[model samples]
Target: MKANDLNKWLVQERARLIDNYLNLIQKCLGGTIYEDPPLQALGSDKFDPVLREYGWDWPSMAHTMIGQKRLGNIRQLVESVLGNGIEGDFIETGVWRGGACILMRAILDAYHITDRCVWLADSFEGLPPPNEEMYPADAGDNFHTFNDLRISLETVQHNFQKYGLWDQQVRVLKGWFKDTLPNAPIDKLAILRLDGDMYESTWDALNALYNKVSIGGYVIVDDYHVVQGCKLAVQTFLAEKRLSPVLQEIDGVGVYWQVANGTSSS
Candidate 1:
């Protein structure tokens, strides 16, 4: 096989192996697996929300919760920005099992791009307990108590390794967003994915990184519609910054938009 063909085959094979592993784990954990015909027919959506979220009720694995539609959008955004000569790295602020960020690295690896980086920014200790005194909306919601939602940095690195995509170009930022994001060493960003499911987490990411996102870059919100606090934070940030980019829905819960040139707070 030609060099390009060889690379393509390897990428596909690695992906298949990982999928099999995930399926095996699901079954081992007594989780029922169901296929969605509509999504399968469309060949877009990957994980069924009903199965992954409720049916499984298991820990968040090193798999995508954003589904196929959102995942495709991430790949397209990366391709578009790179093809258009846009410069910078890709970052996901609230990486779960690091699936989305791994996908970013995989895209770059497959295309032989070495200049850009993929950043996995997360607490790695699960969500912080809501500061009810300040963010009343999160009051009584103990997301931090969900041990399954928290995955360590080591496991995330292992997840990347499973796909043969682990490398120095993949950076991990560990800490709460408020403490870590403001001083993150990211020079610029081509794709900013925020899966931070709360007002404070979402707001901090935007405050620290939105301006650094290059013109025409994509900002994807993974929980914008499903989380009230997250939705409000996005709206408030956009309004405060006077950014008018159209928010396009990626699925039932996720949304994204391209950053227009000169869009930022003074």
Candidate 2:
């Protein structure tokens, strides 16, 4: 199947899972559990205004599950924390459709953080050849071809513009993390969202940007639980550096870590 088709399928599957989970959560909380309400009600009402502002339309309930329910939870958490901070800018190392960035920009606007910027860094060329150390012996090429899956900087820029986010607060850095991260014009980051799929990409991003993450800041590894290599890289790096942070799992795939103390301002 084509990438778009695959994405559609993935979105559908994820949405189904989210619906089940939401119902389960409501049951646990003793709330009324409705079956797949309108897409607008799939998640929280707080996100509805932003979603409408961005011209986001959910053709299927599953689309809302993937886009709003699953991904929306992560966006809400980051926005709630970083949206009120005075520390640093927002950064996303691997952006696919620019959805998360758009959500973040909305949060920035809603919070009136005019001075802080959001840096978007992506190759747009797809995944680089995986280093063997990062991949399992049994892993195949199924997840390797990002060439067709990756969205270009220009495309993402257009996305930002479409969402009315193409202002001074948004910056796009185009190239591989290994080469572009050093010169990405960012001093520090309050929220660093890592979406890189492989070990090498994750490692490069962490090494280059982790030090710049402010205390009380958040580091969101998008593929942490979904991709074994990505998880390994994060664990290995934390082990080697002797650094540990509280990790919260979102959507069973993403991991969010908060720096231990709020003393440092990097």
Candidate 3:
């Protein structure tokens, strides 16, 4: 075989491996590869396509709550950044179980890209009680009351290791978004995924990190349509910044958009 043929074959092989690796990540994280979680009706067809498509039901032992479609959305955005030469790292604020970040890191490894980082910013103690005084949209929110939302930092780190994707390029920013996002070490981001699930959490992420997203990068809102507070925060920030990027929907609940060059707020 000629040298060009060998190179083509190598590229094709790598692509196939990456595809397979990502598919497995989806199944594992979605809990489809395992028996139905504890609460599912015994033998009730463990797979719930509608819930999995929109991430409406949380699998007891799965690493993510965003479901298969949203997870696939993250994969698409991260790959889009790599393909388009978008400069900077990838970050998911409000990371739970670190599934999305794990996938991001795994993708980077498959592509052999070393410069970019995968950052997870989360409280690791679950959502904060709504600060109604400051964020009216979050008033009466009860996410803070859910113990399941509180996945410790140690567990998330273990999740990263479970996939053998933990490495120097994957970092963590632990604290509430209000305290951590403004000081996040990222210089620029190719993808900003927000799953904070409330007005304050969502708004804080955008206020601190949205401008740092590179032009042509992506901003993925995991709860844009499902959570009233999240939706409000997204709309309010876009209006405040005068950014009107066209949103791409993910299973009707999540949305993403590529940043336009001049969309950065002054």
- Identify the candidate with maximal TM-score: 3
Q: Candidate 3: global Cα-lDDT?
A: 0.86
- Write one digit per residue (lDDT tens) for candidate 3, span 57-161: 766788886888888988888888899899999999989888888889988987899999999999999999999999999999998988878999999999989
Residue 82 of model 3: what lDDT?
93
**lDDT to native, each model:** 0.76, 0.64, 0.86
lDDT for model 2: 0.64
User: Could you give candidate 1's per-residue lDDT for residues 1-266 as a string of tens digits?
Assistant: 99999999998998687556544433322222344222232243344555444322232332555554566677778878988988899999998777778778877876678999999899999999998888777777767886756889998888788778899899988999999999999999999999998888999899999999988788998888878999988898988877877788776778888887776321
Q: Is candidate 2 or candidate 3 better by lDDT?
A: 3
Winner by lDDT: 3
Off by over 4 Å in 2: 1-66, 82-86, 133-142, 262-266
Worst 10 residues of 2 by lDDT: 26-35
TM-score of each model, in listed order: 0.78, 0.69, 0.93
In candidate 1, list every pair of residues with a backbone clash.
Answer: none
User: Distance from true position, residue 159, model 2, in Å?
Assistant: 1.6
> What is candidate 1's local distance difference test score?
0.76
- Model 1 scores worst on lDDT over the 10 consecutive residues at 30-39
Clash pairs, model 3 backbone: none
